[model samples]
Target chain A: MPAAATEAPTLDSLRRLTRAFRVEILRMIEAAGSGHPGGSLSAIDFLTVLYFRDYLNVDPKNPSDPNRDRFILSKGHCVPALYCVLAHKGFLPVEELRTLRKFGSRLQGHPDRRRLPLIEANTGSLGQGLSIALGLALSAKLDRAPWQVFCMTGDGEIQEGQIWEAAMAAPKFKLGNLTWIVDYNQVQQEGLTKDQMDLAPLKDKLAAFNWHTQEIDGHDLDAIDRALAAARKVTDRPKAIILRTIKGKGVSFMELQTAWHGKAPNKEQADKAVAEIEGGRR
Target chain B: MASATTGATRDAFGEKLAELGAAEPRLVVLDADLGGSTRTTAFMKKFPERRFELGIAEQNMIGAAAGLALGGKIPVATSFACFLTGRLETIRVCVAYNRTNVKLVGTHAGIGIGDDGPSQMALEDVAAMRALPGMTVLQPADRAETRQAVEWMVRHDGPVYLRLTRQNVPEIHEPGYRFEFGKLDPLWPKDPEAEPDLPSLAFAPPNGKPRRQAAILATGGVVSNALEAAKDLQSRGFLARVFNVHTLHPIDAEGVVRAARASQRLVTVEDHNLAGGLGSAVAEALAAAGQATPLVRLGLSDFAESGTTEELYAKYGLSASHIVEAALRNLA
Candidate 1:
């Protein structure tokens, strides 16, 4: 729609935006004194590309635009990342990012559609958001609207039986307008995903179920952009992009660690994580 | 075998939906591959452009319905009652919890879904729908009422759950019987011969206004049984007022309080669990209203056992005889 916002976003621009999203997310989680920063930081690049360069048809000021692309954060624990992107996109004032999880603030622990715009559904319970995304996609097809549905899930959350149920059904319905990106960080709330539950050959499993599958380095902004473009080209079946990523890619202390799954950083840890992200920005 | 009326609530739902689709361009239908059973095939045939078949997936059907509602479409999603609620966490979190105006039509509800056994019967649907904060739960008695319920649900400005039956029931209401959500319709007392119209000797209201007494609050298929029980109670000189409390959630609190105050004795009958159903809603209303009417709550005790609709109704004390016995005991 507006000629795809020309001047192809450069790797430097992508990294800078991702860094900004990570920093803002870390600051918000630190302000709340309790949030899942590891996943948020890990998912920043994927979310950044989707919102800025891919599927979403959003105008930050007009969050309720009837034909806007719909995004569902199935891994709702990583709401800090979404809040950062929404704030950066001007859906909410950038100053409001500090209000994350505060008393009487729109930013709850998970996305609440009633309280926030551009949040299509309420998703805190794992394994349920994909079903909703499928519904939204089906709705778009029925209404003959030209909008796509994007849902991001956690690798650990794949253990849920309902996720497979939804996965199995999406292809059967031929939902080409729907895309599911799994943040395959290989770490769960308890520990390593392999130690907890093995979801290996994830791509093969999705392909077997009739999904157009792609595995990419989640932190590679260019690879994410390419994969999203490739996803749009496949117009007959649903698409699944398995993003290989580190649990906390930018912050060295939290990287690939299970303890940061849902813990907030104290003042000391916050200062180090912020400095790490800000230094990466340069 | 008794020739059953060709009653599959899905048929009424589909026909009414197709009508709504023609009248309102925004009305769309979504099905989870049970189109034939859920009776959405008619709408699918007539409005193929507007019907979405999600192919045996209930979760996706619910999520897609919510998205459609967000995109300025009034989507009605249909599935068997068991799958509709068993796979209901999506509807709870995505649709109702988000306050999306999606209408969930669940067919094959209660023991009436005979022969298919317990897995197909949605005995606990009322509990599941009523648990949501602002959802409107409707259980219509017959085909005509089902049509009326669907129309009301479309006009209603929030999430709704319409419990549909698989068996045909005798038509009770006339063509233009006015229907209102959150209001009870009294089927009996059509004439002086009706039980609720009997002239009793005394026990009138102390303020000289006629005191409404001996009321039965029933919903869904139980309304028919309650009517039968009222007739028998009248023949035995026990006049009882029967109230069809159709809308389970946001229950008729004022009507319930008025009945409790007038009768000083109330009984609730439903084809569901005693907890969080019509009985529980009435009990909560009476409790909040601070009324001390003796209440007899009738429903399945816990888990249900396999049986025909009639056998299960008798076994679970949901038949006309059981209602009459409960009323008699309350009077005693």
Candidate 2:
């Protein structure tokens, strides 16, 4: 296992890693025959910065460490992004990423902790991650443990009422150790999140729920790093970082294309996507 | 004779949980705004730091309970049975599929939570919970059993769904009776010493002209009614034996087969829906064991109305007289 990055990687290096991961994400989905590629691509950059930038206190060797920082992908259909980051961190074999969504594979279609212990909780059904995250943060606060919980949710996923229920709770418990990152990729499985269900006034609603809020361009590695660092200093209230991202972030043909939200790229399209991602096309 | 001493199972759960909370530091309690009705206030009062009030949001409460369990805390999440199981998707993934050690306490089960009507009653909770893999479903019959079951639920490592009653239930077990998982609690012919050397199948007394015998399997809020039904049947020159089915998921299949062999017929009564409660479990057990024993199921066929507990029980065919009729069907 690689040692924890004592120093943050350069933004350029982080971008390079993100681009490589974007290609892996597309290839794995194409290999699986069925998966959500757009959201995975949109969330990969944030996940890359979060995992590689050393903002999360985790040990790949001891994935079950009680005090290790917890991460939950609430919008679980995009688990290809999480799997890519975890593989790179040595939590699981990088080669196993190809076996995703297959029979008897640890890389379940969704993040299943039972099959893979590195995942903090099983989440595929939407709007459940924040509550689980709040519970973890609340537990840590109860024990005065020096650990933080980070959860990532999609813009369309917050349509569930349970998200607000959890949003209301984290502030009530004063869970300052928890950080929620919303991958506001704007697009959803059906269409744009707004056309499906308007999450307009998203930041104001969250702020009214008493969360410390931050808004940033999700593709900016520096912005993600800064928001994570700011979340750590807040020891009295939970923090929510809203990452404005583009669905199908890197692949030009798939960018903002609702069809790319869940449909896997074909062999021809997969080859083109790899070329585009490698060529640094946005 | 069944003991006249009675107490609500939710109260027993609360008393036992508070005691367990004191003993187990890792134990945490979460409530969905029904702490008073579910009787978890006792736990909250004693262990203020350990108790979490998640308001009327049962889904979030369930998710948080799973999170706490993952964080190595024994979380007892409580709400009315209907509201708790209404979030079946969350439980299906977070608690059951995840195989997290979360204890789900669903009080006010079935029509027994009278006056609140069908909306508040969890008539299908057992069915929903039973469908989930690796979920332990328990519906203790009385105070003694509930206390023991609560203790066992905490000590056991896995997901558990404990269905409790809002109404008081008569004591069915004798003093010092132990609660074992996946086993039937024999209630009738109370004195074991008096029935020494009883035949393994088809017990008969001297000068008995093949006395008509039937076994009554009951669970949760209806076990006492079943005992009463048994007594009523015996007074009419028929022999009836009663067994309490506390664990509903990993049901006592062996005991069910034994009871089927020992009696001429079998009758199952529960406060839950007839489709997926004790009766369905017994029928499945009998079918799996290749027993063609005649069986009768007595429970709600539809949603119950708002009324007193006794009136609702009678209306829903869960009363003792109704149980006696069910057992007597096609048997003189």
Candidate 3:
């Protein structure tokens, strides 16, 4: 049986893993010649903490086990983060990350579960993943199963009407086993999310929906760990963590830059990004 | 005259779902706030634990239903046909492409819905549902057939869309009706077993000119009109055959080919848009079979207006008289 949240992958090591994920994501996106690196960098810390720190009950072998916890990448534009983390955890071949965005790549521009069975759904048409995860959560609740479902969505992507649709539903179903982590990087593809469309008082909006809401620094591994632990104790309402993170978090030049939301870095920029993460400088 | 004998297909869908709920443990129903309209609430009332009422959110409901299917539950998601089919992107990516075992029930299909106007009428639902890969589209002719198809849908393994009507229709089948996927039900002569091609003799019209034999292929509530038109044409000394096509996607191409061989012309009638629906499917199938038989497509060529079902049918050329007129005009 895989460890569940209280086991291996200590906090120190998870911090190290997050840095490595940042490097891998940048290099992979650069190699693919196209992909969203800003969102990938912004969301990697929470994904690393969730997947590596024994928080999720997953088996690289036998992924379809009925009792396994489900993970849905609602923010699918940043799948490079997920690909790198899954590879490091041995769910996929590490060499496959470079082939992303290529023709016939299992890793398409968006998630295609048929190509990669470990993927729960074909997402990236933003605001769809939460609903898919809600189904898994609702099913587990119906069967009285112990598995919980985790989903991650981008801050700007939540502006889609369907996100609110899924948001309003999960709490009504009293899906306590469901947790949605909002990667509130504050920057969308066009510009800063606040300028594009203000999502101020986002926590209150989610709270009013009857969700157990929390605001945390998304880049902090310790805070992510604590928030996830707290969410597990929620009994009657779904959990929503508004994780405030910086776009292109680990790279100084790319940070808070809207242009980096989708573009792949050149080899020169890729070298600088990898060096920054390696040198332990934000 | 009790309504049960001529009840709506959606009513049959709801009633059969309740019966299937008792028989199938894995069966679950989900609705997008229009359970009352879609007729899924009957099962919801009986098996409340298995029912999920996702209020006013069709996309989420569909996506969730896909997840439920993946999680080993046979989920039936329901809404007004237009609203349910309007969420094509979610269904396309999540359910159809995933090949999840989801039964999508779209009630209040086509202009038969009456007065609710084009927004509610799913005139193009079959067009959208048929466009998806692995999505089986079925629209029953009446109560018995709807019940049988609903029961079969629970047992079928992949994605299926069951289209139903709000308006009550006359029960067309007998008590022991069985729905076979990809098979067409012959209705006009009341002969499901008859080869229907017994009219090989070249018949002359009233003016004494020989013309080709013709057949009407139809589905849903408009089928009764097709039956009437077939009778009228036969009485007028023209060979008329009618087939009620329940399964629209994996349509009985064999039956269509046989009918094409038997008749020189085929008129496909439906209460939907001319594109991507029953007529389009039949045309594609016949063309793909390398058959050059002429065809007259009968259906809504434009958006519908608020009116009675009969009024819409007449104005849109879906009435029995229109079918007869189309047969007289084409079938060469």
Candidate 2 chain A lDDT trough over 10 residues, lowest sum = A1-10
Clashing pairs in 1: A132-B63, A135-B63, A135-B64, A136-B64
Q: Give the best candidate by DockQ.
A: 2
lDDT at position B77, candidate 2: 95
Alpha-carbon local distance difference test for all models: 0.82, 0.89, 0.87
DockQ of each: 0.62, 0.81, 0.72
Q: How would you encode candidate 3's per-residue C-alpha lDDT over B266-296 as one tens digit per residue?
A: 8989989999899888888888999877889
State the TM-score of candidate 1 restricted to chain B: 0.90
List TM-score per model, in order: 0.92, 0.97, 0.95
Give residue B330's error in model 2 in angstroms: 2.2
Most TM-score-accurate candidate: 2
Reported per model, the fraction of native interface contacts reproduced equals: 0.70, 0.74, 0.71
Q: What is the lDDT, from 0 to 100, of the residue B301 in candidate 2?
A: 79
Error of 3 at A114 (Å): 0.6
Per-residue lDDT tens digits of candidate 3, residues A1-282? Answer: 343445577889888878888889998899999899999999999888888876788888877888988889988899989888888889999999888989988988888888998887778888888888999898999999999899999999888888898999998899999999999998998999999989889999999989999999998888988888788788788999999999999999999999999999999999998998999975
Per residue, candidate 2 scores C-alpha lDDT tens digits across B261-285 of: 8777899998988888889999999
RMSD of each: 3.6, 2.1, 2.6
